[model samples]
Target: MTQSPAPLPPPKQRRHLREAASLTQAQVAERMGVTGETVHAWESGRTTPRGRRREAYAKLLASLTKADMVTNTQEAAPPPQVTVCLNKKPNPRRAVSAPTPAPITPTPITPAPITSAPITSTTRTPATRTPASTSAPVAVAAHGPVPASETEPAPLTPLTPAQAFDALYAFCAPALVRQTYLLSGRRELARESVEQAFQLAWQRWPEVAVDRDPAGWVRATAYEYALSPWHRFRPRYRHPEPPPADASDRALLDVLLTLPAPYRRTLLLYDGVGLDLPETAAETEASTPAAANRLLNAREAVAARLPELANPTALHRRLAELASAERLRAAEPTTVRAGSERRARFWTRAAVAFTVAIIGATALTVRTAPTRYEPPVPPGETVQGIPPRSAPGTLSDAELKLRAKLRSGILHGPQRLIPLAE
Candidate 1:
């Protein structure tokens, strides 16, 4: 008879759910599709929660990032301290001036139960890896300890709150934008994705603020927002596609965009960022096998555009000859919604208010017209004619710039956009 593989080991201890969800064990258990006893058992590591139930469990964990619920605990058996290489990316659109956190370099996985969980740190390793070159601000506990035969964890310094936010911004900003860019191929639209994630983090910064790994919080937030396209979650986005400079690139992007978000992210994270099925599974919170399927589905969908990844381009060409059926579709124009219009108005009003302030400053200067003092003329223009000048204002150029900036500040400023505008 066939022998079954061993069960997966226990991850370090973790609270079944955090308080941010404001959910109790009973509520979590209900969402987890198990008995309260089962929830306790899983958290306690008495027995493993399996199958579709486990998927549901992961989904709940991913979504539970609602309010900032900060909990630090170990599961029955801690997961191996594997340093995940962060996917480092630069946003082509926005200017991010923050310092990047160091790269994560945990000990390689080993197959033994070890004491003292290797805490996460923020330090930089060489840019040996792509995308995930940055370090994690927090060392996250694995769902279970890795095999003892694997790598060892190396110690590194942890980042400060400012560093953490910087790292968080850099880490998630590019990844989220890239995924959105690949799908929408529009910078403004991609920015919408980034802004949504950012607003959520700001709203719940207190709880998510302290975690060693803030990128996880932000990334999870981005995914959560992108998960549903309901009106509640939709943000105003009025981005136009950058006519891909190259036809091939344009075709490639079109094909890539056609895939669903789950698959789209999986593709970019793997192909563009260099993550494997298992780790991709963890980041996206899917089972390794299920994540594999999502990746496959995404690839299949893009095969036509990215034929080499899916099928041989030469063979596809030959097949095209045989089928003799060519179908072309007219591209649909992008439409900006009402909320986006409101956002646009907000910026416009701010611009107008700023212009008004500048005009007022000019008027003030005219009102404070310098006393009309006749210049003292040096006697005799026989040599070099020069007229004496009067004293000017006291403020320095730097001080004047500061004054101008401050007086025009929007602090306690009136609302820029009207609540409802067609």
Candidate 2:
């Protein structure tokens, strides 16, 4: 008896799906809006996603795994080729001036039996058709036999909102991260920006999935998030290594980095990420004409260093190919450590408290602070120095007492002077 392969354990299965999707536990947690421990628990089989969460979990796994399977199958299978026969055999019954046959009375005819022989055309010109045994019917046109390579598979049926989101994430996440990386010049930040954008997209997927260009919407959202100034206050990005780069790419990147931010982003969008001028402008928040001008200027800047890139067409093509190859590995989210969220919460509360304290202190100081101080003076009192009045011609009782005290040496200075108003 043949032995069957062992089924994957729950933890292994969960890890396999996560890794296959190029996602980290933190990313899954963020998508599920749960803590990393919850995801870990589910993956470890200590717990399982239940109810609607289970439904979502299954959908996520199916979408990513299916996408990978499709890609792999396509890569492994070779394209089908159809052999076209050019020789046209003349019909033995056909004559240059054969008289038309008369119409006979209608009669019931037995259907011909299916045969193994190749089906041939009854007309003067013989048509080539594949034998039924070989493959499905090859679509033939009146003009000529259609090449097998020309045929395309039927488009996929519309997916539900959740499936659509998962599919979108699987298909576009890597590409989106690459585009954002080229724009931001930071690999980890690029990933975060894309993740944040995808998070937003997941929340509003009903509107996003139905858009004409869902990928474009995601990319645009990422670009906007990457450029946001508030991103600085968030945890800094850390990565094991930078995205791979070749000599030519490194050279181009070095030169590209020298360009101003607007020009750099415009160039990357137009050439690297393959956005059109209008889309680029919309993403960069500029007009089409302005985008065109920036692109022209950016190309000139790049061409100045790499003279071979002077041709706009060649430059766009080369840059687009180079940039599309940069698939960033999902960085392990470091900030998701236990209690980090709690720490963040605590800091947030602390910051609010600090702000309130500062404001209260400022208001109290303003309310209680003394205004420009001035000594109070009796009403009608002259604040100015007055010249001493002429000595009194006659001494009053107080002056007599002062004189006696002065004579007795009890008084000093000018008061002790004799003839004190005598």
Output the number of the TM-score-best candidate.
Answer: 2
Q: List per-prediction Cα lDDT, in the order shown.
A: 0.50, 0.61
Candidate 2 deviation (Cα RMSD): 25.2
Q: Which residue ranges in model 1 land beyond 4 Å of their true spot? A: 1-160, 209-213, 226-240, 282-285, 311-422
Residue-level lDDT of model 2, residues 1-422, one tens digit each, is: 96433333466577666655556565787787654445655665545665667777777777767876765675466444434445777666854442222211122211111111001111011111221232235465756766756765444465555555655565566566666666666777787787777766765666875564566677778887876667656665433345456788777767876788788888877666544466578768999999999999998888889999998668766665655556565432222222334555787899999999999999999999989988888678665688867866988899999778866865555654444454
Per-residue lDDT of model 1, residues 1-422, tens digit only: 95443343243323423323335445666676544434544554545656777666755665553322322232123434334334656556955443334432332221111111001122121112122344433334446544544443445556554454444554345445544455455555555655666655654556767543455456556555555556234454433444555565566667765778778677655554343455467778788888889877876777755566464333233222211221211111112123334566787899999999999999999999887988898787554576766787699999999789666754565756333433
Give all TM-scores, in the order shown: 0.35, 0.41
Residue 171, model 2, lDDT: 50
lDDT for position 50 in model 1: 62
Global local distance difference test of model 2: 0.61
RMSD of each: 31.8, 25.2
Where does candidate 2 stray beyond 4 Å?
Answer: 1-162, 203-212, 227-245, 324-327, 331-422
